[model samples]
Target: MSFEVDIGYASARGPREDNEDFAAVVRPAPHDEARGLIAAVADGVSSGGQGRLAAQTTVMSLVQDFHGVPETWDTTVALDRLISAQNAWLAGHNRRRSGEGTAMCTLTALVLRGHSYTLAHVGDTRAWLLRGGECIQLSQDHSFDHPDLRHALSRAIGLDDHVRVDYSQGELHRGDVFVLTTDGVHGVLRRRELAARAREGSAQAASEALVEAALKAGSRDNATALVIRVAGLAAGRLEDLLLRGRQLPVPPKLRVGDLLDGYVITAMLADNGVHRLYQARSVATQALVAIKALHEARASDPQERAMLAHEAWLGSRVARDGQAGLVRVHELEDPSAFYVVYDWHSGQTLEQLIEDGRRLDVSEVVDAGRAVLKPLGRLHRQGVIHRDIKPANLHRGDDGQWRLLDLGVAVSGREPEAARSLHAGTPSYINPEQWQPDDPVRADAGSDLYALGVTLYQALTGRLPYGEIEPYQLARFRRDPRAPSQVRPDVPIWLDHVLLKAVARDPKLRFETAEEFALALERGASRPLPAHGSTPLVARDPAVLWKIALVVSLLFNALLIVWLLFLPR
Candidate 1:
């Protein structure tokens, strides 16, 4: 696939001094494997002694040293190597200025190879993806705190002798858009708007639009934007060509080893209370793979067996099209074992990316919505409901495509479809209808739709539609949620209304299905929603505040009184 990229960057000495010390560089790599594209963004630490020098030098040196990356190695390994190399360069640079260096800036670098991407970052600068009408953040801030910080970064390229650089890998698909920006651009634009703008015309235009939006929103620092769009894929399938005729359950455990068919188990990648994911390899070609299995305890329980079967069933259905966005599952040979096998993927989960506290641009959030909803739409069409859709379950693959995991089995018990009860899923991300005990486990795409809304809201605004509520409190979501934009003014008004509708307390008021909800979100970026539309319960009534306060006070008083009465008397 021939790749096309466009970048727009602007810096304003906004409301401040002359040194708009931020600097960025976009260069093509020399290696054929890399398809050779590299971009870096640096924000000079306004307070640090040598902020400008640190940023400029770091970005420039990174671009120069990038050619040294081994073309034979995987992108993940290469990214780690680059971060180490750059940090080392900065360390020596910092030492030379030792007593003189006062300012410290952050660095974020991106490397594109064929369709894959490797990202490394520091501070709050961000990287995002716009694919299938959604905007998805691809990097995390190394900041020490959330919202904003009054202090310098906890770690910068030159601040420490050795910096623990966190990085991840992802694949880029045709129409996939990537953005890199300083806090100046992100702090003001939000992810939904960024994603939407990225889609408007070219990457260059998107970059310009982002900087203008940030400036308009009152950015106090120098602002910059680097936009890269994956215009087309090379003529062949990247993964398919890399590993062919691979078998499952490689030499290791079913989900852990490479013995199942041709797939080889690399390592256990992730585990929650219910399932364990394994990073595996292809036995035939030694390709990296990801395998997912149910927890042993859940698999052992007779009640959970059916749920496990249902989960595998749904995985098979979704992967029937062999969409890279959805994980591949194997049919159980014994049907008695407690695990399912899946293709391994390398990338950050949405939860990991959001921990940086940076919100995604509007276009990025919408791209994410589409990535999730496209497969979800396929699942719904086939009568499958991914009861749980959250950052944790959504996987951004090495190919840059988004994949959904742990389908059908929100809780470990039975076929979610046949059950007439609301049983599983995480509270913050679960849909409103999922709270109805009488609701059937089947065709609740509305529930999934609500989850999609919550995911999009969190991605773009950096806040949940209902804020943070306890699991038991989810039952109260029977009412609509507050608009996301209201919670965070920078959130585009269109997104605020769309998310609220998706998570509408009443399923009737919510998007009827994943498809319907996705359409609204996809188009909502370009067109704002009507302000007079239905409002969510979260914003409509603070009456619950009084009730909640009374309850909290009562609990506190009760506890205090009990303590006093129990005292020696």
Candidate 2:
């Protein structure tokens, strides 16, 4: 499958002394086709002193910055962040040149990713979709209501410190046409007239015709038109993704001195039943790295292969912008086998550190929690949930940084439908609700917090809070486990309360977000601690209270029966 498009644009100064409109279409390289094509148009505020610069910079920045974002990010997320940053830069520039006047502009952008189109708009510039011989407006004009002030924009880039961009998305099909225009063009031409011109000629000719029509219709402002016609679309099927994974054969029982691609295997790190990990060195750079590949026994399984590919995809998206601890995945150059290569780091697994009797001070624990939660927070913001977060999956580098790892069971907002019975995460660390049959509440950021709480508890005291739970056994969370302070005397009372709240059995009782959990941990020393045994037994351990009630009732009934029998004639 392939995604091919035809793009055309035309700009006119019209009756204005200077043209303040800009537009562009960005085409990705062969390797970046998955990121898709982008079309953007910006119209500068005519009254502003730097109108032309504003329009040019807005369009050019979007085209360049959008592609720089991580491929794993959803189209909406990537666009939102890029636009917000651009707005900040424009606003700051205007402030720096106080007397020079503001740099303000209206923007509309369209992204064709996979099988859908994402539209982002601000101010009066408009976006439209022409299909089935009908033209439909896809953007809302941010202008005032009063007739005298109708031309005044209520929202535009560089107008404020922060801008609210309108966003929408819909599925795409072949032959769909996307149109963008500044107010100068759209305000002058009627919808029907614009549609007629768009359907009359090629995309380039149609764009030029639209601009000419606006100018002839007495448009006093600069006019610009951009047209995009979808020539073809790739299937974007699961098989297409699997084919990429299958480009190279699975490595067969790698050993020391073995060579794959340009990397030479130096030592085997781990060989779990499902996958193998090796420490290798690059032949060209002589840099040490880690290579992970699926086990030969599971290589043929579609599910396992899909998970491995997804792990690589998810990792690539979140490792940018000073996000430390996560090792970036390197793209292979014509590899002969299927595997993932990661930048090697000299680090020790959290599990190994705990087993080696390395004690962490409260300050260190707080810092670690903050480090891990930062990336988790980023994932949640992107509509992703890390289902598996445990000691073995966290690495603490010698540089005093902690990074979360292993997104094998991660769930994204765009995840495909799967069976509800599929197991997720390790049983021992999984939230109690996750173990319930047909559980309605799916694993989320809160669930990740529960697992993190367990890890923290284990690190402080070399024991599981509720004991290890077997996979098939019923997970009973009705008993209140010993608090962290009780298990480890050095643990502060306030810190223990924070951990208890994090691991609460009911989802509602736990922290609602990673940020809240991290804040609680950071401020543990300053906050007031709850009184010992403050939680009601019924709330903490309902099952135990119910048993005691039953035993008491039975004893009272027996005594009453005996008293009546002895007194009766």
TM-score of each: 0.45, 0.58
Tens digits of lDDT, candidate 2, 1-569: 46888888999998888999999999877776777899899999845458999989999999988999987777889888988999999999988987877889999999987556789999999998998878999999999999999999999998899999999876667789999999999998999999887766789998999999999999999999999998887434222334456554678988899998888999999988899999999999999999999999988876677767666666666665467756777644335677878888788888998888898776777678888988888888887888888889888887878988877678875343441235688888888876666554577788889999888887777887778977644434656668888877888888888888877766777788998988887777787446435456576554777789899999999989998888675
Index of the highest-TM-score prediction: 2
Backbone Cα, N, C clashes tallied per candidate: 63, 0
Tell me the tens digit of each residue's lDDT in model 1 across 342-447. 6666787888789966556667667888888888887778776677788877877667788787665543232533333555677777654444455533436677
Query: Which stretches of model 1 miss by more than 4 angstroms?
Result: 1-264, 272-274, 294-299, 322-324, 331-338, 408-422, 436-443, 471-482, 525-527, 532-569
TM-score for candidate 1, residues paired by index: 0.45
Pairs with steric clashes in candidate 2: none
Clash number for model 2?
0
Question: What's the true lDDT of residue 245 in model 2?
Answer: 68
Local distance difference test, each candidate:
0.65, 0.81
